[model samples]
Target chain A: MRVVLPAGTTETALIDGISAAGASPELMAHTPSADAEILEYGEPTTAPLTPVSPSGCPTPAAITRAVREVVGFDVTVVDAGLTEPTGAATVDLDIDPGTDVRTPTAVPDADAIYDRAHGFGASLPEDDLLIGETVPGGTTTALGVLTALGEPATVSSSLPENPVERKRRVVDEGLAASDLEAGDCDGAPMEAVRAVGDPVQPTVAGITAGALESGAEVTLAGGTQMVAVAALLRHAGVDAALSIATTSFVADAAGDLETTCERLDCELTVTDPGFDRRDHTAMERYCAGEAKEGVAMGGTLSLVPDGKMAALRDRVETVCSRLGIDADGSPKEETGSNTTE
Target chain B: MRVVLPAGTTETALIDGISAAGASPELMAHTPSADAEILEYGEPTTAPLTPVSPSGCPTPAAITRAVREVVGFDVTVVDAGLTEPTGAATVDLDIDPGTDVRTPTAVPDADAIYDRAHGFGASLPEDDLLIGETVPGGTTTALGVLTALGEPATVSSSLPENPVERKRRVVDEGLAASDLEAGDCDGAPMEAVRAVGDPVQPTVAGITAGALESGAEVTLAGGTQMVAVAALLRHAGVDAALSIATTSFVADAAGDLETTCERLDCELTVTDPGFDRRDHTAMERYCAGEAKEGVAMGGTLSLVPDGKMAALRDRVETVCSRLGIDADGSPKEETGSNTTE
Candidate 1:
């Protein structure tokens, strides 16, 4: 399965406690390649920890690298809208770019984005794609779309604990600023996402749905944010051979992801990489629920068996060690293993 | 044959008589799809004539359309660097992107571009590929690359009449600005292209070379600019059973293309899409030495039969007529044929 990470940024990420997708938005905007940032590329050495989820345990960048190492699948990062270039050989899909969801027209070209992205996804010329994403504060837009679609849904967070009220307030604020009313998106998903969702939701949704129309099965490979995409598919009255895969963290989180998938009409699969046994204290964060899920950490992990979890853990450790990042995701004494070093 | 159009702009194209690729530099910056401005994408329909080549005759855009209509193949446009988006599904490859070639460090990441582009080309997953490009001032960069490689070559221009003296001045100025001296690129084609060429040269060179390395039959499908790519492959000691396919205009042009190919060690295939018999006055201009070549018009036209030239002519006329463009490519009365209209 191809790992597709549709990424973006919203000011919602800046609101304290809203997201842990990255150490900070600034860091998220520039992770080089997962392997590059961790192993090669960049320096005078900035961000010793690279970018990690709020939970010190598992970083999306680490897990993404594990997917590349363990599952050995093709990986593609789509810049739906980003603060800066992610130093990777990315497919540029900023046709509509992206914007702050706090405004009424968060994605003014929602329709065009859908069209072009549909073309983009449909044109992938690949088979059995596993589409994932990592946009900071993406869940805020997810909740906004879910609320507007009248889905009675709550999404998981990168925070160890889900921030229901804060997320709700952000959604509420976004809704207040938006022209959408409850159930307005019942038949208008693009408009719903346009008004309040981040750029990646509709883009991934379109790609998934469009590729499905082209008769390819796709895994909406992220957390509850994927619920927004499924909701878009469900509302658009299009049926896709789609399944939802995420981390066991989200599977075990407080969000109503399973029921959300049922109504949205998609399968839900979860994989826990069993980070608890790792020597690093940060690996135990999943057990504590600090960084539940982000990236396609869960879905990508699902491609491998429970047996490969050890390999995944080792991959992360190797990358972190090489980058001088401790298991807890902080700078440590220079390892001198890095090329520039 | 997949049409690949790698595009960028050089300030060299800004000098009067330097390039007629577009009507004016401003108009040149946004040529909807092909190398010429088009009537299809923009609204309130600007540039009634859409920017054509210096000649009042046929456009490479028309030839590309001819290829699409007659040959029917997948087309991919790579944005090596451009002033603005081309209003098409394009691939973006600007690590530093690219600036005017007049600067010493025009393409800062030449090696990376080559590597990434080679990866891109090698990863095509397709068996056969045809890559074309449409940088307005690509030929000037081509000339620079050729000169730097110690090849006494003169490339054809989009302008009906080759801007030899003007292009020579730009190439000399660019060479002077570039740190590379003549023959310095014998084993460093990318460095030469980087120092004196546009983003497209090394990029397509890398793509073509990488695709060939994958044991796939590839066609370097443009005119003189493609020579720069062939040079890159030759100098790199990389061997590929690569062939060149272009239009009669470039084939019959006064340039030493034939001798260049002989010394460069590549088979040259030229197709003469009989533009002389076409009733379209604009197309007849090809007979008059205007708009000689551009886009992948010639190479794409090569994919079909010589007899299809009439059909290709008809396709352009139909597209132009539907877009409210007259046979000469100027705007006629609004046809209400425009989707936006």
Candidate 2:
């Protein structure tokens, strides 16, 4: 079965890891300027899409294109949308779909999107699965997901001086935005996703559950965002095995790796480490968090096998060679679509 | 110790396995034109050095520069000056150094020049080892070296098809021109080096042996040429541990791997597997005996503490990254000097 990853730049590493393991995957890129926020922070604040050149389509459109590229097979596109904060606020929060979203008093439309995306009908394809995600400020979102589920989640950037205070503030703000009470949410993974989770987490959870029911293997083609999604899946009682494809740089980063793996309960695999070696400072700035940390943490718990590292390295090298770019570390003249939308 | 590798178009992958393990290495170009003659049915002729827009230095000079750049230590450059075919007349053979009027026999004098560059005395600062070589169809000289020692050494180009008949004829002709009988020679590895080996190979072996005697760590940096030099060292009973730094491409290639390894009884460490991956076809060429096999067959074994398969893969990725290259089954762009003299 083929899996598709609608990836951002660093996210490409995860897709490479998956593809290296003999799984067919299509990489659909969102235009560099597409400002679909996957994480929400502080008070409910609405941040409009930045008016920059939309280098590509939104995540939904990319998903559609991916489904089309893999012909002659049943396709399943998991909707992993996320909501941005409506206003400037200081706490972190997330929401689970089935329980919190299902309640009559909750945000009805917000919950409805989750139902539509997560509720798999009998008419959908049986063998294919598109594992995806949406986690806003995911390292913080991961913090929330872990805390609400009663794990001691210490989310910090992978920089030399691990910044725990900033992560704590984001997590606290996220918890405030989420509706589920801490006591009620304790020990329930889905409840955590529902309270502080963004749209992508629940959507991926539903997709994994649906795929498991249909007896298809699932390849989670994302970084930390998928980690949050996997947490939701476990909370929802999905018992399917998961394989994660990601870059080696992330896999090698220091973090609460063992905890993340135990929570996800899946194997993790990494592909090329070169991607993590790229300069992502701008990306980290815009994301309001370190991109490397998220990428690395996301790769930790995912199911990735060994041996494909060399193959993936070769593939990246092949592509770079074609572009007349040097592969060993020298900066090249920028020519491709600028990713710094 | 630092090690520098000249970046040749598509040959970086040839030695990546050894470079990644924190070995100090840099890639530079030797010549502007990438010219190497294709050995076919006739005895292969050496292609003229792609005329340097500026004048080109001799092979020994190029080796000297590489050693200085990579190792950052004093260097003893050995020049193995063998111009005349010591045995019989065969096909019109044109190895690069053979075409130059400076002749391979002038290498000892060249060594004196290198010694002068470093200021030698009765008790000089531990002489940076002598790393030597000769270019342009030097494998034929390797055969001559073996023949002069009374060993039935079979040599072919590292090209895809076996150039056995061509190589045999070249060896016969070169041997016929010399006064040394198959068995009537001094056993010093330098004897073969001075008689027939190229300037680079013998010089490097001499430097390596010299360093070992002085109780310094030594590395032979190059391809099949280094392997031949190592074999000579073993024959001389030098006890210093030796390390060979080369691309993985040469190691996986066929030919005198066993004999080279057995002769040296030392380890070979590859810089990057990507190097081997790209040059597989070329490696196959050498394996098929279409060309004479180059150095570092047991090179991996020489890596201190040895590298696991994973370490090898990591090293490949690291080298490729440093070169600003990737591993996608294609030839990378030449970054530095071209060795096609």
In terms of lDDT, the best-performing candidate is 1
Cα lDDT tens digits for candidate 1, A246-289: 87777787557787788777899978787777767556756776
State in Å the error of residue B76, model 2. Answer: 63
Q: Each prediction's TM-score against the native?
A: 0.58, 0.32
Where does model 2 exceed 4 Å of error? Answer: A6-79, A82-111, A120-130, A134-136, A156-164, A177-183, A187-191, A222-224, A243-246, A270-311, A317-341, B1-341
lDDT per residue for candidate 1 within B150-181, as digits (tens), equals: 87767876555566887777777777787666
Every candidate's lDDT: 0.65, 0.36
In model 1, what is the error at residue B3, expressed in angstroms? 2.1
TM-score of each model's chain B: 0.87, 0.50
The C-alpha RMSD in Å for every predicted model, in order, reads 10.9, 23.8
